[model samples]
Target chain A: MSSTLRSFGAIPAQRLVRTLLLAMMALLAACGQSSEQVDDMVDFSPPSEGVSSAEKQPPASTGNALQVDVGGALAAAPALPPAASLDEVAEAANRTEPEPLSITIPGLDLNQVPVIASGVTATGEMEVPSPLEVGWYRYGPTPGEPGSAVLAGHIASEGVDGAFRYLERLKPGDQLSVAFNDGSVTNFVVDEVVDYAKSALPFDELFARSGTSQLALITCGGDFDAQARSYEDNLVVVASVVA
Target chain B: MKKFVSVFLGALLSVAFFVVPSSAQSDDARIHLIHGIPGVNVDVIVDGNVVFENFAFKDTQDLSSFAGQTLAGLKVNAAGTDTTAIDAGDVALPASGNYTVFAHLDADGAPALAVFENDTSTVAAGNGRLVVRHAAAAPAVDVKANGAVAFTNLANGQEAAADLAVGTISAEVVPTGADDPVVIGPADLPITEGNSLIVYATGSLDDGLEVITESIADLGPNPTVVNTGDSPIDAGVPVGAGLALVATALIGAGMIRRSQGITVDA
Candidate 1:
């Protein structure tokens, strides 16, 4: 065993100890580094869950209503067949026109930044547009719709500042606007700014299609990996429709 | 042996520090209630409690909160009277996914209840899902999208569905093997991406057939990763610095091996 170790150029015992210490430090630095910013005003529940049963209750009913006879009704109504299995058909050819054309954030001094619809890449990562433009997640809701619409932009690329470079500086109550193809504009108010580790982002909540209308502006933040050329965290700015 | 112990400890520590996020989707079922029986104002009672009074045709309600719960003595009575129209005893809502319950006429034109589960699966980008359900008191019909037969021979109480690119398509419903005498409209239907647009052939054919729609949204793939930036511009500590530290540690390990009289390869 010693001969084999020698042929492999055995590391000195002190140097091995130092290497182990450095690895430990690196591991420690990467642990429990949560940056989520909690906002009390935002209701994260889906729309269905938000409604109460009492709201569906009819106006005070007369106590004279008698118990319904189920036997006769059941005899008259035939039992429905089991749910049918859906058949796969050929794909349809028609496509919808993209709605959102541009976005504006007055507080950030971003005026009418061009927006483009984008989809996921082959690897399942969101395909980001150029630093000069913002990418709207095409599969999600459009801005001002009854769901969360996601828009992602770059903070910086290759030492150049991106369209969302100052996204972290946005505060609650900041105004933002989105213009659609129909020449209509929807205004929004920033609800909160949160920073999350990329691995820990709540994808369901960020892309939910129920509940109040929302817009999520996303960009890169936190530690940058030089080798991977990526950021370790994402900064999200959530905004709600101005109604 | 000491070196092996230290290396093992380092590996164990790294493993202990790794974090994995949970990716479980919510298990809450989305339920919608629709009134398809025309010419009658009714009171909807679930579990012997009147949930909707004076409910007219085309009135819809979201019953999502009742997911996973069974309602006993589900009854629809004439408005302001005790006359029972349809009684569905002990209806159990699904624990998850999307569903719609309709009060419509069966093929025999009798008041009946039909429960259809809506597909909530993620749609491909740039596409939308369309579901055609036959709930009217009509015979088997062919559903046309953009004047093409998309769903054929769809009988009462059955459903057919497909995914199509997001756009507007002219929809029409006609009797099987006949294009003339349309039972329903050639109305323009908008197919929005990430949503399942369910069109129901509702109301009795003799009483005037109609079409009602329900949309289930948010069925889209979440991006596996969002890499919005390149370069370490915002990083407090560059990853290269950490790599450098790791490289230095490896070099130290090499030095220690040399001190232990391990032969250095030429």
Candidate 2:
């Protein structure tokens, strides 16, 4: 072989040997895996037992894509169905029978004992102006009278916490209901929730008998006086049974 | 040199073969396996019909189990899907142990399922309820339990939903250009008295669907006729005012008769 050829072969041989050694060193360096990687892999162990979390949990989906957008969580429903055009839902809701109060407000622990005549003030006894709890306080002189059918409740109490704990949160339009003895129920929509002191309650308007059917939810609010021991004020919700 | 190279390449080939297979085997290792429910067996029944019984799930089974059962549209309980019906027999009699029924792969309480036996059926649960009366006259939804009825006069349409709960409530919306209410109140509205019905007088007059006593003489003051958009709900409850009037009238008549003719006192 020529001297030139021999030198060239020798140079190529040296470079080849160097490249292999570099590759080997790189591979050895990688052999020491990262500690973080090891930890993630260990945690790759399937999740522990199932847990329902309160922290904003993404809703779990199990059905076809169109599963009524439960807003994902079972606790809450989607936004209120759009109020149909008056022409749309014009038909009066068919209420065949009157239903009595079905539930108590969540926070308050009030007793709703059924009695025919709402206990009148009788001059001496302090008239329990409001219901023990504030919900649908059914009242009537008769089922279909144009007379005043009064109702009262506590805006807040430690027991029920407040019959209308959410009263202050009410907007102009809300709803209410009362059950009649005639297997018929009366419904009312809230036009206003006015907070007043106990003495300021519209005694005449609230306590008087009216000509047609109506309902009121009374509760004490505005101010609570520790000395008087009663709410300094009251919350009066005025609603009328839809005509 | 050739021999050395050959030996080194052979070693590389051996390492690749052994290392690859070892990894492949480890990848298949399942250290832990848990079935959703103990014994994870299930049975499904619908409308007194057996759909699936003690069905064990086969891994990778989308829905049907080894029992050849399909569950996607099974009608469950409470909030159960209405797509299909599930029966008591189809449930895995969990040996009488308390088992949580989770809907849609849930692990909690079973949902209420609605059977659309008629053209329209309402499916509701918890604070949510839907009432649908496929029939024309009768109320589509009747709440026998202590729950709320959110929708009434639920018109026939897809968007007609209700958010009724358990309690007495009234909801009425007057259409534009409706009647001006008869203004029945002292000053403000919705006054509740023993004999009087309270209402907030606003907007044009929107009529109610209430049933007045058959006899106007038995009614209080001026009786406004109730508007019924659809057939009235079947209720035998008479308007209370009539009964009160009859009682009062009878007492008055008896006193007058005694003054005019014969009474025990007279």
Candidate 3:
């Protein structure tokens, strides 16, 4: 990561300024912006042929067909429509319009900004290794979808709490705002707060689509009991975009 | 004097465009840019079934394209939704043994796959090849004399190469509190190579009281909502204590994967 002196150290003054400007230009190359706060991912590009609202959703939960997830002890619940296939998702990303998204909740003093990438930081937060388990997906759909646009932050680094140290304080009815590059600011209100043992977590809940656009926020919570060197639970927050 | 300043500024502006040939590319895959903690984790699923959930960094696409200055002077609501940057990733692993890796590709042509058992009873290194066919398939991987290539020939999307270094990596010198994040000789085992390593915390993250207070005081253009006693409305705060209760049951099995091996050439 060293910026070595150019070969033409004694280049003309005019050329030196040119070089200076070029350095700035090289820096202009933004790796890529990620929408990681949410847990799920859609291609960066929009779907080529989007399904109409009518075709996009399942029939009312008339107790008919619900995508269900079951655990040894946990009960089954309706499932969500899986996002486009992997190929379609990637194609969407290729055509995706990555604009800077930022948000702030005045009542909560919450800042929903900074989408981190793997081994590539935004402002802060570290990169999860590659072929990452869930590489904490950074680019995802806007909230209100039955998907978990998951974003993982570090909690402990040598006896220290990382970015998501105090994620257990938010309550229902709180505000979660999103500001996109298009100048469109959208806010979501907390609707549900559910906790699951990572083993018993309702992966289905994150993607449970019910016609209502929902946003899912997940983080590691519970105690960091040093003895165990791991957290005891998971925090999941479901919210709906402020209509 | 005024003329001299104007000309100097003019010259500076003129040389800005072509003088600097970008030495690096900004195509990134789905991974963190900075190593925050000790390991990397990813849980890959297709349809509804879990294909792989790796907690450690193994074979993954590179996301080093995040080399740029933060956007500034955003006077207007940056509109029109034009793409400012893009990234691509493709990885290659060469070994006589069987190895399988998966990534989320956008479309059928965007992905490819092939079995490398080879044309004859024995697979030859240079003779074996696979292409990106579909999600049901593996990324198009080709074996070359010196190495291998895995990527789409379509010249679209953020295409990056995942280099798998095959060899005995030196034992890692993990952070033992006494060491300064780095150690001597084959330090940072399993994951060998000269590339930076990142670790993600398992619990929620906040600046804590003292850390948060300092962050606010030093709020430059880049504002980070680090936890502080003064900022009661911090976004990092968990929705409730219920999360702690749930974390207990999931931490062990929740660890998507244990150790994934990867090597990056410096």
Candidate 4:
């Protein structure tokens, strides 16, 4: 809606980058890799580079394995099942309905906002997110599934910046992390950013249930119309699995 | 021929595994049975089970729990009685397909059943598909959408289809010969995007013709097909035959070498 709202709420881009670089350096140091590798590991390129390089890397797994392995007194834990390959994990995702807990975006300085399943309204419009949380279309595929998983949040509400206030500034290669209810996290790299007229948004492409796995983040953007009390366009950020 | 048969069977088996039925808890087939026979109530039976009793004229029953494919015997009898009126024999019901069966009088005034297959193929973004079936005992008719003929001269037991932009449309049924005397509507019908809307015109003109509407939603475009496209011939000279030829050639060379007392590597 037309208002004097501006994104002074979100952290600055350079600040976010420096913080992320420091965090990646810490993680690399913990993993026995030199901090110098942080430059190559967390390189924030455009969406095309993210997609092509994602194809060359292994599935992103950033959990604290050492913490799990060295938690307590030295009693042997039960033997675990053979590890599954990336394809096997993706295939298995089809049979499971993993509930998402929160979403984190390092590039935008957006962290851990709760997510919940949502349905369309009686008037046939998708249910919008709360002022500070995101909503996932319940009828569509979930994240990690072999389809486009949609997440929508409010950019601004009631003349205040909402959770996705900085979503319009996200560039390709920005990393996004989603935590599931089961404590598992998935990493994705932004591939594309598009703004479509509100009347002509691509529903099929954003909600397809059979194709390459994708996560689409949507929010209102463009000039706000005072008469209509809504934005004229919708910003969509498309991302692919980091693996 | 033997190799081809094996290859074909292997392909079929592979497709069978890939087609594991949609695991969504609600992937069952949705079917609607419409009683269009004028003045006579009927009982709809499927697979020797009476599913709808005292099904009155112009009534529609939705069979929502029927799942998977099966050869189901469909018979319509006088309401609340076992006297057979129209026996549709066995019909196949496929999974995830939405269907409508209309029981109405044929052109000869005899009771008959016409099954309409609803196409649920996904339409382009912001579009929908509409299909009209002429199931009435009357002559050919025209189905108009927004005052224009979308289906022309569709006779009894025939159907026509058209793709339309997503929106509410005013549709009507008229005799093919003239645009006047609109029989059905100027009714506002909402055409949902990515869905198929089916309208069946049933009953005779003398008995008050009516329109029955059903919809099949969630028809998204299919995923890309994986094509190996290689035939058995591409396997190159059968393994057994090629191996035998090589063996024969090796034996001939061995014989020549042995006769000359030349040692040959095995």
DockQ each: 0.10, 0.02, 0.03, 0.01
All candidates: TM-score:
0.58, 0.25, 0.29, 0.43
Per-residue accuracy of model 3 over A44-90 as CA lDDT, tens digit each: 11123222321343444111111111110011112222212223322
* Residue range A169-207, candidate 1, lDDT tens digits: 999998888877666777889999999999888787877
Give one digit per residue, the lDDT tens place, for model 2 in A1-243.
122123236654454334333432332232222353223222211122212221123332212221222112211212222212222222222223343432122122221222223343323122332222223223333323565554443343332333344455555565444444443444456668786655555655654445555555554555445454455556666667656
Task: List the candidate 4 regions with Cα displacement exceeding 4 Å.
Answer: A1-243, B1-30, B46-49, B57-73, B220-266
Which runs in model 1 stand beyond 4 Å of their true positions?
A1-112, A117-123, A138-149, A157-160, A165-197, A210-215, A221-243, B1-27, B45-51, B68-70, B80-83, B93-97, B230-266
Q: For candidate 3, what is the DockQ? A: 0.03
Docking band of candidate 4? incorrect
Q: State in Å the error of residue B201, model 1.
A: 0.7
B88-135, model 1: which lDDT tens digit per residue? 654544434566778888887877877776777788766778888888
lDDT of each: 0.65, 0.29, 0.29, 0.58
Residue by residue across A117-163, what tens digits does model 4's lDDT show?
A: 76554345677655456788765678877888888877666544556
Model 1: colliding residue pairs: A10-B257, A11-B256, A11-B257, A12-B256, A12-B257, A96-B166
Query: What is the Cα-based lDDT of residue B118 in candidate 1?
Result: 70
The ten-residue window of minimal lDDT in model 4 chain A covers A1-10
Q: Comparing only chain A of model 3 with the true chain A, what is the TM-score?
A: 0.47
